[model samples]
Target: MAQCRFSSSLLLRLRSARRFSSLPNPTTTQNDAELVSNILLHHHNPFHAMESSLQLHGITLSPDLLHHTLLRLKHNSKIALALFHYAKSLPSPPPLTSHAFHLLIDIVAKVRQYDVAWQLILEMDRHNLTPTAATFLILIRRLIASGLTRQAVRAFDDIETFVLTRPTAQDFCSLLDTLCKYGYVKVAAEVFNKRKHDYVADVKMYTVLVYGWCKIGRFDMAERFLRDMIERGIEPNVVTYNVFLDGICRKASLHPQDRFERTIRNALKVFDEMSSRGIEPDVTSFSILLHVYSRAHKPQLSLDKLKEMRERGICPTVATYTSVVKCLCSCGRLEEAEDLLGEMVRNGVSPSAATYNCFFKEYRGRKDSESALKLYRKMKEDRLFAPSVHTYNILVGMFLQLNRVEIVREIWDDMKESGAGPDLDSYTMLIHGLCEKQKWREACQFFVEMIEKGLLPQKVTFETLYRGLIQSDMLRTWRRLKKKLDEESVTFGSEFQNYHLKPYRR
Candidate 1:
């Protein structure tokens, strides 16, 4: 979906949603800019007020104005929809265009208002407006963005049923890339096989497939695709090998002790092989190598790669710096990591929250609570990036492990208020902590909330909570949790002590 970016839009320059005592009095002295000012001010107004404001202008809406206004107020879906409808309700309705519809769809769909979006599509159909590939493209992107991979796949079927029998190569690939990116590689392949005959196969298409398989850590399948592409006379490019290397690093991370040497050799062999074939490894290539070494906690190798990158005259990006910094932190080389961070700032590479997170994690590991909290506050105050949910989980778990129950409560509430989260891990850790503290009521409350949010508890969940409940004679709360587990089809194994999130895992 296209970003509205209303803050920078020229229309928002009408004036920051400052409510003047009265609407700008339209007169001969007033101009078109002021008129837009009055209309655009509705972003901060309710539907009725915005509709009233639009009527006060006493002019028919123009398609161009509608398009621009929607773009400007896209962040506020209700007001945009109100203005869109107000334009249609005029005594002499102005002509509407697909641009207006698409803009509204883009705005509403972002908030996961799929029903409203589909309704707009129906309205477009009634207006005799034919949908374009761009229309479906926006839908596919949004669907995938919301983790709706199946719906995104069905939207591809929509392209054939509603838009065209045979979508262009670009359209097909757009959907293909969307599906593959969000861990929907199998669905992507199925879509490809069903539609592959309609278009000529290309290297980019196979590259996406390779990336998809690699993303899921199926190295064998990824290599098979690489071989298949070559057999089909579609030579792999540097980008292809870069993505493959990234996959290698991710796969290696899961079994570092078992595959450390083999993975490093395999990764470098591919890197050297690319060079030998005259495919110049780009900065991304170096960053991938740095990241792989970082994942392996091979700090020296990471530095060597960093030096090699500089020797090749490839300027390191933020990602490159982050990879090496991570390696330094993970290996307990805090002094060297701090020096590198200073170097990163001196070299004008803006440190991302990820850069700071490395230090935050190291501080936590050392139980340096003061430094950890300071780093966390600095990232928030500077607005580098929102602290990720993983960071919040770490913080919560850290305080809990230290037996700082009051601080743990504060952090838990703060995460919910800040919208970072109380994800599954957060809940699990907090529950474990609360139960250990014998705060059974709070533990049960959090456990219920976790279930309400559709998160399944792990094996440790039942073993701890259930055993405690029965022995402690808290059958009331126990009944509630047991009912939830039953409703979710979670089972206590025949051993009556083991459990898992999924039945198969149990």
Candidate 2:
């Protein structure tokens, strides 16, 4: 009887333990669903609940899960493995919805995965999810980046026909940007022409198109676009003013004497219009205009713009001071240029290679070899090795001008030691200097050395050598050069041949 009682007690204890084990632990699953829902809705922190849930569920989250998680998290990766897996795992994968497809397209486009983006779009269409204007815009941007402008337009036409909804202003702006980037400014203008009735082109679109025209040297077209923008009630922005100013600066820098006056007038007109529109000029706008005026020898106007910049609370950049210095130098105002350089240093604007080079060039032009050498030494002290061929050539010219043959040789050797070999200009300067000193034999020997070093002497070299020989009345040398010219079949223009033969005839 006692054994039966003990057995019954044991059975009752076993049942109690089993029941306790089977009961859900409140803390384990405690409000987990609520936590997940709250995370999905309220908390944007990607680190919340989802990863923990996956761990708790003992499920290894694949790339697809991570990708969808990231998309939900809004982080962009170059290759979205999660998205790829998500697309692969869907049973009867729904057509790529426009929104999701566009997001993927943009991500891929930014990463330059054109092929993958195109494939995704094709798969989306296969799933019958029609693309939208945004879809086409993303493709257009990618195509332009890939240098496929023609294909971009064809895609745009397809989107227009099938997407039903009219393209937005943003869409037109993107198309314009693509066309402008690819040197198809005319095609970009055509896009604006067709869409003019639908959506008025904004300042950004017009600016891009104008800049594109400027890039292709179509300044007239760029001006017309600027006028069109104003006529269409689109006020130009700082970017517009900056681009216009830059275009003027480029033209003036290239052809200062011939086109300077007209370009400066047009630039000032834009600046005045900018002021009338209550748009304050930024540092870039001020700098470009200052450069244009300075190059045109209009220092007073450049100074006035500088004052205007200061009044507007826009501090001049290093570029601004450099432009001013360059302008002053070009107009034979060296003292003023030096003062401006000193002022720049006081203003905490560090001079660049260009600034020092300008100073050196001016000094060299005045035969002030001492000052040029001082500046060159200062440039070296600043740890700025001259990278420009022009800078090196200027120093060489200065040394040659001073009859400092040893220093010229030193500079040439230094250039080669620094891994910067003599270019055609450097060779020309050296050869000319040698011949001018009545060292024809040395010049010919140097010419031979240059040829041995694989440097081709320019036509100018032959002319200089010929002139030197004739000035010395060395008929034998002239006959040798003529024979060489005939043997080489170097076609000399009538003027050059006449110039060479005149001294020989005399």
Candidate 3:
């Protein structure tokens, strides 16, 4: 379904391209301008193509021709900017519309060219043309995003006076949501308070405020917004309640003792209120509850909620299943976790990295190296979940524990084949494991490989190698290793020398 949606969207874009192609070119001569325009349309380096067409073929490009070309390349800001510069340099500059300026400004602002974009705005003002509200919004969003909060606030403060269009609830929400997301909840509230009267406030705007306040742990402010929404005769929807529930549960987990106990009770009260208010609890609602229980270490309650949710015909999602699996693992119910993993797969719910990691973790916790190795193989064979660095580390460690050092090389090869080869930790573990088994030759080889890759070996790694060589009475190998270390510019304290000469014993 996702692939189909992507394909459909791509087809729509191709159709749009065709429509763009059919538009009348404003250039005088059809041949030269048409070629440049076509080059801009099809060629990867349209700017270079346009220059080559001009220099090599003596093609004369007018600003009007470039203007039409700019329209085609508007989706690509970098290309549009280049084309604009090319057009602006012509003897007779094309008559660009205010709308065209807005598109240019918007594209530049998106790429964080705040200074350049602001200069364009000033130029637009010098021409006595007012920027559209969309342009101001884009600039304000960029300023706020790039840590220029004061500038953003100032711009937003003077937005109504500058931009002619009446600000809509959407503009307010866009700015407010952005402000809230970046830990500027107070600024968001201030913006809301200042602009609420200008635009007809909607449920989404109120919810944004509520979510923002809740995110910053200001439950009082969040509730005040909720009440304001209610007084304005706006019915709070499922999303609104879900925000409160998620906030409450998250806040509950932060408390330590008595406060922690009460906060959880309060979360449960919110859940009860949700049901009492006749808003059917969806997967999100249940996921929040399950997550809270998992955090609180109440796996039984999480399982019970899962069963109850199933009975209510609310199918458990991958997130819900992952949390439950984690809880089961934490509570030492490995068998139940495995059973749930099977049920999850059978029900068409693909296991995530976390789900597989849970089993790996439990097996490792129980010191069952063979079981962990089998689980690692199953995870790779399934191909549904991508093995992370932790997965490789665990499998490599398991091979070492089982005294199967020969298999370690094969696992390393497989890890590289999977495209997430050994990180520093992987090399360290492999080198340490090989040294422990007195595989001095392989250890030295891996050590050199690690150094060549620019992954500096740890002090422990050097100690392990030096100690291993000394213990095996391979003094010649130790001297060669020390010389290699010197050549690599890897420094060590004089203390290591004392240890190296001390003994060959463990």
Candidate 4:
């Protein structure tokens, strides 16, 4: 019986080695690329030409090849599932395994096919495959990311039932981190309390719970945990203190009208409290201090802290430098920002997309699209990193401000092709920018596309489009949309609510 067992151990290794997307890997050899393209060309074939390609290559179905092909075709679920079914039916080496099923399950889950995902999970039993912790993590993380926190909780519950094993501390910790990071801190606290007795509660576990409360700016609850943990004899660590410090800054950010000096001073109190407790500040603590000053737009103070790090023989991270860079950029000190950017690169620190975005924003402000696009060209040549959604959003906004609709459209398509896909902000900015340019029909098209993609447009998005159509005497278009809403679109949770149109002279 043990001899027939199959798992995702090798599959996990393969997955870790590759990026997750439906795009072909850039590093593939010409021959391998040709084979992938050939097999994918016949993706809709019922007989599964993937097997024929394998036979032609005289290569048995290996885990590496299987993982590669599935990821490459992830967007085409029909072909990916067909490949999975063919692999399962194979009576030879590389027999049906948990990895194939899990990968397919994740693919379906990405498109919100939860029922199909659950069925795939159940089907694993027929193959004598046991779902592992990684499997549940994928499900839980995706569900939470999709704003289905309750469904994530259900997946957490199903872990013990499906895996035939008890949930580990790591599983619980991961769930808590996901939930808290996504603003489900209350639910995370409930889970922690519900299972406190199942394992030996330690400082780390309590710290996770404390971090969750502090994460959401619930200092009262966080302090309660500190007292409770101490009473339980579990001492708080530097990380626990750092959570409070970070939370203080996060809370300060919520009220932009507050005095920057007062906010910065109050945020530093957390660090003072840490020292009073005999907890020495670590690199993270200094990073948080830099964030404190940066958040208040105090670039010189931020730079002072960077110099202090060197004076104390402490090495600063790329993020540390980026904070000052960002602060300088926001303050219109582009030369200083550039100096720091070059200094970080000289120190062998690679700037992230966020670091690059600071410069783009300054150029966009100065209407220097030439310099912005030039920097993007350089970024395209840099193989180590790629543009992310934020980068695309900046470009979209920059082009839209110049009324370069065609260029904005090209950027929209390019960002989508890059595979990060548009988030809510992307769609929102694009639609409104189109409306501002009197492109009502195009704006409506994107608004509906946003809805179809499972992203709910803001109330303001609908209102802006409505006003644009009405003010432009595009009543026919407005009537068409209203009819569509009345006949079909309202059922989609009335994504648009009842709002006063106010589309005419009052």
Candidate 5:
């Protein structure tokens, strides 16, 4: 059915091309007609062929047919082809109607061809086809998708000046949504503040702006927006509440000078407000509250919140348990963290890769390699084959610390066998390990391999190798590495160079 619909749409476009060609100059028309017929029968259905036919014949399709074809192609998932054909069929000193250009812009946007869309808009201006509100909206959406919010707003202003249509609430909402998506929450807030009186912003738009501000750690602006929403008699939704909660949690996490007590108090205030407003807090809300409380070293309060969740008939998710486990690990309560992991299993909440990673990191930090390796094996048994780079680095670092060079080589081989080659950090960690073990020759060989693979050694990597060579009293070898660094133009800090020079002078 889908294929039939697509083929039918293709046929309709071809018929339109035929009609367009037939009503023209005879000599040119004959070529267009043959081209159109060939396209309709061609083994490969290239939309570009029709475009080339229209251009060759100087065929200008009527605005209505162009609009209709665009809508049809869009609905049938051939929008890119439609726009290409439309651009080709557009007459020089093009039709004064905005609809043709508007439809073309929209089709280009839907296909995410922003550069071509913008070029077409520029052409529209050259042809004196004024851009409308709908035209600006299409441009705004495409720009936002491409992370060009500033350009989107400029285009919006141009739309207003050229078309004489005032921007609507939907316009402002679209702009705000775009800004928020691209991490420009402050710009979004400014736009909202200036335009709040011009258009009635909805809860969803406010929520989006608030979430954006919160995500980028602009809590002050987020609070102002919340207050503004309340002043406008717009009730906050669950999303709004989540954004506020997230803001408080993020502030607590990032602010070293701010007391955890303040974070805890702020979290409690939000929770109390939700309760007062008869908004039942979801598991995510509970998780944030737990995380903040755990960070504040209020473990009892964190655990109590979990109990509160159960009492309120809100079942905890794996995410909830994972957050708690991570909190325990952060607080150095490894036993408690492990107990929470066991509890998650008992509750049938399957452990995720994050769960294994958190526990494995904690064990490795304590030099409990056996347990960490056990968890690593369990991860593989569970079919989580791609251990993160951090995990691999940790494993390699652990073996190196224990002077287990043979095991490190085995692990490196296994990593390659699994088709997960070393990243810069991976190579650096192994090289550092080799250096610490006084395996200068092996380290130099690995460095050569890294260079051959086009991996540039980090500053610390060179420092490690240089230090190893100096300690081994291999000044000639160190000079060779120095020459390589000079050739590569790897900048060594004065402090590092001076440190190296001190030993060489001795």
Candidate 6:
């Protein structure tokens, strides 16, 4: 039975290895340079130009010229394919080399025309021409890049038939990475163990497996792979340890409702294990533990980790400071968070958008709009962290609540000028505020603008508009808007389920 299986496999390989295409000689163009120039000039209309060149101008299609033209349209698959089809339209098609065919296949695959590309391969096979291994490798990699990992695996399965040379470890690693990326770690592991004897297992291969195991929360299997590497005399590097540390920390510190304390303890144990294994903890190691401590609300422990990193001559990264800042903000230590922000800048670590958002959120919660505005100006002046839509939304909403319409308008204008263009929520808030103030005309204008921008106002937004129209006695305007909205299939309803609208107690 084993002999029969081997024979069947051999036959499959031989059949798959048969030539995909063999083309007879085609007509040649007199002036290759002139034809190429004409093609280049009309690359945007590649197919049309190719047709005109052959059918109208009586210029024969040259494979070399077609190859050059296709290269120019490499980024645009549709145009390249059009040119390809035009070349094949001639009585004697231009002779396409293996590289030319590979380029066309790659361009077609990039645009996700897999069916058409497969048909091209079948046509190639009909012509008794075989593609090179490089061609298959390019196709496989592109397929994986396009998130067609299953197809890539199929391609990988039959890759042996295309390439004449031995497959490299890099090639196998790419396939393993793709498999692991899509949560096929078990299959990847099986393939690795089975094929490790065929190709020498490099550190990257081991790392890929360890990462895959850790990614799926299979730390036990990850540790087993680590031990397997050690047994084979392959020492786990800092990257490998970081992966393990990150996994353990993610489990322990992230979920407060879970066994948070136990997880933190587990993470610490992994950290200590790294030290015991003579692998010195790096910046990433410290960052992971600090993040765990911060998320777990252990601010003192997080601060201590920061101090330890500093004394050890390991300057804190932006992430390390950000974690501590976030912890401080969560604990309502606003003053300390502010001071820490200054210190972070002194240490040459710029605050990220998240850092600014955290402080802005706290300030808005406390109704300290003055402080928030100052922080906003400071953020703008610093220009390190560009303000996001959330930042603008908070400021706009706060100003509206304070009945500062002019200030809100200024901020809105600034938001637009700053390139953080208003989103649906921004327009909603603005329209709601304007309606509350009985500014029906202004509110209607904004509503029109929102609709023009393809932003559908929520039911609350329509309610606000309706109430404003009733209060302002704009029945005609309200009727027109209602008619338009109904025509657009917009149904008016209550506020979003997540939000409860309170009634006015007179």
How high is the CA lDDT of each candidate model? 0.76, 0.69, 0.75, 0.76, 0.69, 0.74
Best by TM-score: 6
Clashes within 3 Å, all models in order? 0, 2, 0, 0, 0, 9
Who wins the lDDT comparison? 1
lDDT by residue (1-506, candidate 5, tens digit) is 77556545544544443444245455444443343333333322364445423432433443444445444445333433543454554555224357766766777676677777777776767666766677778778777777777777787777777677788777778788878877877778777778777787789888888889888887887888888888888999767898789877865652463677677778779888888878877988888777676556665666777888889998888778877777677667888888888888888888765666677667767878777777776766877547666667778888788777876786787677776667888888888878877889899888877866767777778767877788788889878776765554443334334333344332
- What's the best-to-worst order under TM-score? 6, 4, 3, 5, 1, 2
lDDT of 3 by residue, 1-506 (tens): 77446534433432332222244454433433444445444434644634422321222344344545455665667666766666555665545567667767767777788877887776777656777667677788778877777788777656677776566778778888888888799988987888788888888998888899999999989999998998999878889988987887776654466665776688778778777878788999889988877777678888999999999999999999999998999889988998999999899999887778787777777878778767767666867688777777877887787788766777888888888878899999999989888889999999988877777778789888888788788889888876777766634344334434345575
Give model 3's TM-score versus the native structure: 0.65
Off by over 4 Å in 2: 1-184, 191-202, 215-220, 230-235, 248-265, 384-387, 418-421, 438-456, 462-506
For model 1 the TM-score comes to: 0.63
Ranking by lDDT: 1, 4, 3, 6, 5, 2
Query: Which RMSD values do the candidates have, in order?
Result: 9.9, 19.9, 10.5, 9.3, 11.6, 13.6
Distance from true location, Cα of 479 in model 5, Å? 7.7
The RMSD (Cα, Å) of candidate 1 is 9.9
Per-residue alpha-carbon lDDT of model 4 for 1-506, expressed as tens digits?
43112212222333344332344444553334335534454424546545433332323445556776777777877666656666666666464567777788889888888888888888877777888877888888879878899889889888988887988887888888888878788888888788877866777777777778877778789888878888988878898887767766665662464666666776677668778879877778788888777767788888898998888887788778878898999899988998998888888888888888888888899998888877877777765367789989999999999997877887789789889779999999999899888899999888777877777778788788887887888889988876755554555664545544554641
TM-score of each: 0.63, 0.55, 0.65, 0.66, 0.64, 0.67
Question: Residue by residue across 1-506, what tens digits does model 1's lDDT show?
Answer: 12235423433444444332234333411343345534456334553645544543444345555566567677778777877788777786657788888888888899999999888877887778988778878877889989998888787678777775567898888888988888888888888878777877787888898899998888888888888878888888988998888888765753646677787788888889898878988999888778777887889988888988889888899899999999999999999998998888898888876887788788888998877777667766877666777878888877777887877777777689889788888898899888887788888989888877867777787568766676677879877887776665543324333453332211
Clashing pairs in 4: none
Better of 1 and 6 by TM-score: 6
Which regions of candidate 4 fall more than 4 Å away from where they truly are?
1-60, 76-79, 91-93, 108-126, 133-165, 254-262, 368-506
